[model samples]
Target: MTKPENTGYDYDVVISGASLAGSAAATLLARRGVRVALLERHSAPETYKVLCTHSLQACAYPVLDELGLVADIEKSGAVHNQARWYTRWGWIEPRAAPTGPALPFGYNIRRSTLDPLIRSRAAETPGVDLLLGHQVTGLIEEGGRAVGVTASTPRGERRIRARLVVGADGKDSAVAKFAKVPVRESENTRFAYLAHFRNLPLPGGMSHTWFLEPDMAYAFVNDDGVTVVAVLPDKRRLPAFREDLEGSFLEFVRALPEAPPIDSAERTTKIIGTVNYPLLSREPTAPGVALIGDAALTGDPLWGVGCGWALETAKWLAEAVAPAAAGRGDLDRALELYARRHRRRLRGHQLLAADFAKARPFNPMEQLVFAAAARDAAMARHMYRFASRLIGPRRFLNPAALARAAAVNIRYHRIASRTARRPHKVA
Candidate 1:
């Protein structure tokens, strides 16, 4: 609970969280000569949330590359490539389709290994005063504008004043709550159970996911001799899952058509579960405060989009607010621009994510696409690009794409109908 000395308040921006988005913003802004105070409640640099499956998609690769951490991340146990999605119909293998470039793949790396690296990088940046173990209990307002934070630690309470306060806290952000920001809650109720295992034999260096009707499961293979596995189920089933997490998690994974390798692998970490309550802020910015990462918007984890979105938001906000924080433009104006840009860039994806989180079984069209992708290499590749988030959902669901998918579906159904007529062999 140790806190930095109260050396009086002076910083261009005071970031209230020290995880992914906050650290990224702190690093970028501080490197640009903007004085930053990066605060976190956790004292241990190695401490990280173990609930996430820790999969970063291709959409985030460019952001990491810009931060100059892509190489370092790759070296620190990142497994590259897209995933093989096992549908009830068939396995959708990776292939090239007619959507944009060959989908650039990304990696899977545990946060236990990734968060500390990024936090350390932020601490090393020249203009950032990294303050760990300090919990911001309240905000200091001046003329209706948030100008500083009042934090408490073992040393005592202290006020660190700054022109701007950034809330990079994760979903369920205390900063957002304290600021009384309006939040729009989605009714989609899903929960996730995650764990890590060693010696799981998976296909390629790729991650894998199973869209098993009402239940969704994922497996992420990292380079550190382990794979992360997770089960996401509708909230209605949460009671049974909570009764026996480890047993229920294993049972769920084993029930998938293409069962995960967890049964064969040795469990390396204790199972963790989190109730999924996807949320997004109605306003990402107020007078002198702004939110980023999950604090701004927490979409469903089914898409594995959280980490990428966090990095993307940090980069976007950094670029948008740099001139303002440096006194070249109005800070409020810059924050408004950041908010608009975030909505424009991610609204469509968020809508899609919320719709998918309902846990409803995939419709006929979805089944057709999965079945076709399993049989056609070209189709699989196109599907890969969409699944990797290279293309927006609109483009992926275009009329032409649907028509092609329909043709494939007809072929598969016809074959199945004929086979059913002659199916008399006992297994």
Candidate 2:
């Protein structure tokens, strides 16, 4: 970390990175009239996250609505739909809404549009100083407490002090590194590849995911008749992907039980990809500083929770620290509160996501529950509650739910067996 000459304080909160999480924090904080310094490495407003499919889960609707972004996002032509999980047993889709009165539909928009839209919103908010082309280089610590950040911008090295510093940077966070925070990463056993296409046929404009056990694929409809097709194959298939990225991806998608129209669609963007996108969880805060978004926790990208979690964490942090920034409470206590809330809300979800990131086959219980979900509407709602992350694992897999799932599977099997045993009509 580079040390820079002392510079006078600029804002109450200095946030590193101007991606989804950082922008969201800046937006909310600025709205509350908290002085904020939002720094981004990139200079251009149009710059967007290249690797993301930008699927915002239904649970994030409230946060978006609170931020006043829902109307703009809808105007941008975002696709509204429910997620349909294609399992070996059957397709598990809830016919009714997932028991939410507010914006019941999840959204899929291209990151190229979404990121800039969010950044623009944040920049327009009063009390936010959006500084671009600033790359974080070090933390400014005073008496064991982080007071500010050092950055190298196009002009020169600069130092900006603050009451509190926020690490909204992505997984490889410079702020986290400077704070000496410990991060535990779960090994990612799968490699993912995706591309954007036009005129891709997505029935009902619904997001579809095929759980091929050890290999997975999906087709997500987005704005303006564009669709994103992605495939996640186990690491063992690396050589094949390397040999022919496009061919391998198309082959995998085409081989799905219910294939998408990738072969016929016009490929609009170059196929983008990533390897070993593991689940990472880091300490959310240290004295005088705090972390949000991927800086705090990053689960597998396969579940499409990155963008949603980024927005959610930003909202959480802003809510926690707003009163403190307004001089009504202790900043340290606010950070502690944020930490506890982060753990309570995301710990279980992260653990499950990390386990699923291993690319292993589903266990017996998962099979039973998924099969039951396909056969029974009540069971499907319960499954969606968990899938949409409205409920925790304990509630999702409670004794009663498990027993109901088991009963449904048993009845389904019995009916299938009876039909098989009956003599076929001769014609």
On TM-score, the candidate that comes out on top is 2
Best by lDDT: 2
- lDDT, candidate 1, at 74: 77
Runs in model 2 with CA error above 4 Å? 1-8, 97-103
- Per-residue error for 282 in candidate 1, Å, reads 3.9
Model 1 per-residue lDDT at 25: 93
- lDDT of each candidate versus the true structure: 0.81, 0.86
Query: Which digits, one per residue and each the tens of the lDDT, describe model 1 over residues 137-196?
Result: 989998888888988866989788887899998888888878889888876667888888
RMSD after Cα superposition, model 1:
3.9
TM per prediction: 0.89, 0.95
Candidate 1 off by > 4 Å? 1-9, 96-102, 364-372, 410-427
RMSD to truth, every model: 3.9, 3.3
TM-score of 2: 0.95
- The C-alpha local distance difference test score for the whole of candidate 2 amounts to 0.86
Which window of 10 residues has the lowest lDDT sum in candidate 2? 1-10
